[model samples]
Structure formats: C-alpha cells, structure tokens
Target: MIRAYRNHPYHGRSPLPQTVVAGWLGITQAQLSRVENGPPLVHLDRLTHWATLLKIPESQLWFSLPSRTPTNRTQQIAVDLLAGAPQGIGLSGGSPTTLKATAHEGGGTTDRRQFTALAALAGFGGNSLFDALMLADRKAEVVGMEHVRLASSLVERFRQADAALGADELCDVAMGVHTRLSTWAARSQYSPGLGEALQSALADLANQVAWLAIDGERRQQARPYLNDAITRARIADDPREEVRALACLSLLVREDHPSESLHCAEAALRASRGWATARLRTLLRLRTAHAYAQLNDVGGFDREMTKARHEFDHGPHEDDLPFLQFVTAQELTGIQGLSYLALGRPARAAESFRAISSGPRAGHRRNQVYYTVRLAEAEYRCGDIHSAAQTGLRALPEVRAISSGRTMRHFAQVKSRLDRERSASAREFVDAHGRAFQR
Candidate 1:
C-alpha cells in the first residue's frame, strides 16, 4: 500500500520519495523504509489509521475501520433523531427536520456548521434534530431500556468524539443529552428496572459532560457534574459508573486536594473490587498513582504505577467497558511520563514520553498533541533545550486544530520555559508560534 501510494500517477513518472511518506507518517525515513520492507502491520488501530489516512476503501482493507453504523435499535433511533427524521414520525408526533426548521424560524439561529459538527461528533453526520426532542417544553414520556441504551451509546460516542476532536460542539451536545436523560429518569414514568438503567446511563452522561468541561478547562463546572454523576450512579446501584465518576473526580482535585483525590481513588478501587475489568483496575490504579504523585508519596506512587502498568498490559478483554477504549498502553505511558514530571524525575519522564510511538496517532489526535507537549516539557527540564523546541514544534499544528484548554495551558507553560532558554532553536521556535501560546 505504501509503495502504491508512493508510485501514484500524481507523482508524475517516478515514485514519491520515501522521505516524503516518512514525513507524512511522522516517522523517520529509515522507519518508513523498514515499514515498506518489513512484515505486514498487524495492529488493528494502526491499520485502521493508515487506511483512513490514505483514504483506502474499506472493501480493500483486511480489517474493518471504526464503524459508524448504528449497532442496535436504540442507536438507529438516536441516529435518526440526530439526522433530522422525516416530518411527524417521532415519539412526540413531531418531525426532527420540522423542529430544526421551527427553531430557526424565530430571529434566533444556530450555526448550521455546529449542528453538522455535533452530529458528526456523536458518530453520525448531518444536521441535528435533537432540539425538538430535547426542548424544555416537550412532554416527558415513559422511557424504556431502549431509551436507556440510546443514552448509553451517546455517552460512549461523546467520549470517543472527545478523543478524536476534543470538546467544542461536544460539551454542549452532551449536556443537552444529559438534560433530556435526566428529565426522563426524574419526571417520566418507567418500570423500576428501566428507571435504574436510565439513571445509570444518566450517570455516564454526567460523567462525560464533566470530562468535557475538564478538557475545556471549566474545572469549577466539572465538580458539580461529577458529584451528580456519583449520586446518580449510587441511585442506580452501578459500581462501574460510580467508579468512573470517582476516578474523574480524583484527577480533577488531585492538585489542590491531594488527600481528597487519594480518597476518591481508593473509594473507586474499592467499588470495583469484584467486577472491574483489568482495564478498569488499571485506570483506578493510575488515578491512585496520580494522587500519590501529587502528595509526594514516592513509594505509594511507584507501587501503584507498577501495578497499573502490569494490569494494563495483561488484558483489554471483550468484557471491558466501552469507555475503556481510551485506556491504551500509549496513554498509560503518557500518564506515567506526566506523573514522573510532577515528581521532578524529568530524565525518567523523557524516557517514558519518548517511548510513545506514532502507531496510535490516527484516532488520538488530542492525546498526541497533549503528550507531545509534555514530552517537550520533560526534555526542556532535562536541559535538552533544542530537542524540547523541536518536540514542541511538532505539536504546534495539532494544537491549533484541537480545542483543549488543559493541553494548551500545559503547552503554554512548556513554551514559556523554552522561551527563557538562550538556545537559538528554542528562541526561534518560540517566537515563530508565539501567537498560538497567547492566552
């Protein structure tokens, strides 16, 4: 495939240089050569990324890409709702398309592009009809397992979208979904089982919304959302949702309230004792490790980090929760690197950050940008000023594209540090992209 791309007719009579493909793949030229001459790539995410990057037809690929198809009845309903269903066919006897038109009829108008983006962010594409169904004046009806399933899917998609696109249209869309689900679970009639399920889905949605708020640097807003998630999770008797929310709470409060963060992490671990998958345990352990790092407990941090890495490597089985998809080995390494930096172990941190390869860059745009900035920080702290500048440069384009305040804040910190250096490369790179680092 690489060879074919290199030899495409657009390159004129000769093949495009390996250096060009290497730059495109963000790998070294030798690495590209080895990949071209090496054994076939087997990793699913890696292959999917390459296929998407190269615009390969799905029919030609050996493995399936990240599927956009609605997987169940609930998903189909959700997709239809987002895509603006035909007039007068929905539960409220109103058309989603009509609702969108009506909403635009008044002097107020929404950005059509944002609507398209929200739909696509939630793993569908087209204008959204969610406004009609989610309006405050809309009558609430009894929700069943299917409604709960739809909410669950929306939460999962919101997480996935945040991973790929960061939190622009995502946070607002997720909040809308949360409001609708909360209304259904609170005021609408349902069987006890359905009610519990709805509450659980709402818990997950609230957690997702809190995460988006955190990503957007709205930490104050995140606290109440996460607290609400915990309450809802407990009401639903769902350990998974409770633990997930608790983990987010741990991260959110780790810096100012390390002890509280530690408490949250421990509580989450305890909640997951019997039922958690290896991935879930790994995440909880990482949260515990982060708390330990914050509190300067080197021994506790090291112990938990060891356990987290071991468990993360052991399994990501079919039983793992859908949200655990982001808990990759690459992300684990990045977190460890960041924690190492927090502990003043920049040399070790640089080593861990350097270990993250380009294989996971496709679907993880936000993480890649964020981790690259951290890697730059580690290098800067280790006194490799030029290397740090170059690493920071690599993240610049992506930083512009993503909407992560947290990542941008860290980037600004590292850039400020790099700017103080006398090195020519550091000064030039810092000055060149100074506008991006501006608040």
Candidate 2:
C-alpha cells in the first residue's frame, strides 16, 4: 500500500522517492522503510491515522478500527425503543475517519440496509454534533444568502467526499447536514429571496443525501428524502434542483420499476429543456436510455443514447450547473457501457467500457469500482473468461475498500458467472475472495 501510494499518479507518472513519500506521510524515510519492511506494524492509532490520511478504503485494511456504534450498543437501541423512536434510526460519530453506518446492537447486519437519518434528530441526545448545530442555530438571528452560499459550498464538499469515501462513510454525515439545514430553514428568519435560496440549498443537500442513501443501498430510506427534495425544489421554484432530484429518483427506481423510472426521466427532461446546459440534457437523456434498456426497448434505448451522445459532443458551456460538472465524457462512456450491457450488447458494452481507465478518474474510488465491475461483467458476457477473471481480481482491492451496493451487485454478478464457468482462474478468484464476497 505504501509503495502503491508512492506510485499513484497524483504524485507523478513515476514513483516518488522514499524520502518524498515519507515527507508527505510526515515520517522519516528510514521509519517508513522500517514500517514497510519490518514486522507488521501493530500500532492501531498510527495505522488508522495513515489509512485515513491516504484515504485507504476501510474494507482494504488488514484490521478493523474502532466500531462507530455507541459504546453500549444494546443500551442505545433499548433507549431508542423506550423513547418511542421510529424504527431503524441510526447515528454516526462526527469524525470523517470513523464515519460508518454501524450495525445494530446484537446482529451482524449493518444498519444502512434498514436504518437512515430520516428521523436522525430522534437520536440526538447528548451528541456533540447535534449540540454544535443547535448552538449555531441559536446564535444566528437572521438567515441570509451568505448562509445559503456556505451551505452550497458544503454540498459540493459532501459530493466530493462521497466520491472519495463512498456512501458508508458519508451518508450519515450528509444526512445530519441536511437535518441541520432543514432546521435552519424552518427556524430562522430571512427575507423571501433569501428564504428561497435557503430552501434551494436545502433541496440540493437533500438530493445529495438521497444519492448517498441510494449508493448505500438504502433505497427505502432514500425515497422520502428524494420526495422531500422535490417538494423543497418546487417550493423554491428551482427547476434545476427538481430536475436533479427527479433524475436521481429515476436512477434509484430503474431496476425495479422501469416505467416509473422512465416517467421520472421524462419529467426531469421536460423540466430541463430550454434552460439546462447540453451536459445536463445529456445526463437526462442517458437516464432515459437506462430506463429503456431496463424495459428491453432496444429502439428506445438506442434513440435516447444517440441523442445523449450528440448532446455530450456539443461540449461544455459557461451556463452548465455546478452539480453537472461530474457529467464528463468518461462518465458518459461508462454509462453508455452499462446501458449496452443491460441491452444485451456485451460486445459493444465491452468496447465502451474499455475506454474507461483509471487515468483521468484516479482518486475517484467509487467510479473505479463501478467501472471496473461493469467492464468485468461485460468481459464475462463476451465469454472472455480469463480477462473477466483477471479484471474481477483487479477490482477486489477497491471493492473491499468501499461500501457501495450497486458496485457490489455488479461485482457479485460477475463473480457468480465466473463461479459457474468453473475455469481454473475463475475458481481461484472465487476461492481467494470467498470471505469478502460472503453476505
């Protein structure tokens, strides 16, 4: 891991010298070498701090860090129940390094699948984060555009953090931010203009939180947040926010309800027309294409994909929304590959997926896992067993590092396919990662 970080492109094309790497890690090169070559470093605090500094995926670590659940886990759950707290509510410690959707008291099952921050405030008792937010709210008499601007900045930070850390470490934090923002909107005094801005920001935050939930595979928990975003967007008369929330909703539902997802895509497209940038329109079109692919409407899928690519080729403009900045050519290529795979065009999908490499998308862990899984699946479908097995193996590190249900699903699909094939490499891959892939 230390050597890999030294070779990471963020440093340069060539590996950095040991001294340089050590400097970045705030250690002497000798100490760094000893740590790497010496007996396994048993110091937990140093390990955790270095992992967090290097942004290593938690799943990739050799040992577990401290659990994020309350110290008295069973007691916490019991208190919630006795207090009549809504079912499936959970809390996260404020530290980014420790952020995670903890398991409930006794069970090994993680709470992300069942718990969410929908009623997060119910668990706020004696929490410093809650207290800090409450103090900030009390100190502020008037809400203004400045607060909205600050929140908008925070939303971007949240998005960046989500991309780097995945939903496991980010969803609860984002949910807390959304909760505080919601409280501020309701409780603070502001002019009509400022109020609309605040609500728009809140809507944007809700959309982010909803995305995090979706990424975490907390779909049921995500629904109400998306709906709330839509309501806030409408109240603020912000069509862009509405389009974003609707587009995300479409993505969340595409696998289960293609028709409903199509409706959401269409509604978002209608709202985005005339005002939205070409990139925004492209994203909406691609989302529509996904719904078509899910419905097995090849013609509809091809048509929308064609339009999406055409719009994408139109390039960036100054009017592009800030949130749409991630809608890059790489993202489009990857999505096109996914749609093609869904449409039963594995050959075409493989070709498209091949265009996505870690070059430009480096440091974006979620994208790496997602695209790698998609590529491996496409390869497996194309009957390139060796390539598929190798690709799947390559993604294992990142797969273990992050918590993304969507990525896990694709990865498991490929793994299952490989298992059935029973090729030597396939069997080896399965056997090697059996524990990690276990539910």
Model 1 residue 153 CA deviation (Å) reads 2.0
lDDT of 2 by residue, 1-439 (tens): 7778778899878888999878877777866775564333222333555576566787886534444442332222222222221223253432121112333355412433223231232233333222232122234556654456545645666666566656755565566556655655678788764556567777887888788888877766677778888887888777778889999989989988999999999999888765667899999999999899989999999899899999999999644666677688878788888888888899999888778854466546687678888899899889899989988888888888776876787788888789897788888778767966667
TM values, all candidates: 0.72, 0.67
- Compose the digit string of candidate 1's lDDT tens values, residues 1-439: 7899999999899999999888887766865775586433322333445567667788885434554543344444454334332211111232111111112232212433564555565555432234333322234366655566566556666776788777755655565556555655667688764556566777777888889988877676677678778787778776677888999999898988999999999998887885577899999999999889888889999999999989988887644666788788887888888789889999999888888844446467788778888888899899899889998888888888887888888888987788778888988778867766566
Off by more than 4 A, model 2: 1-146, 358-363, 435-439
How far residue 148's Cα lies from its native spot in candidate 1, in Å, is: 1.4
**RMSD vs true structure, all candidates:** 16.7, 17.7
User: Which regions in candidate 1 have their CA more than 4 angstroms from the true location?
Assistant: 1-112, 126-137, 357-362, 435-439
User: What does the lDDT read for residue 327 in candidate 1?
Assistant: 88
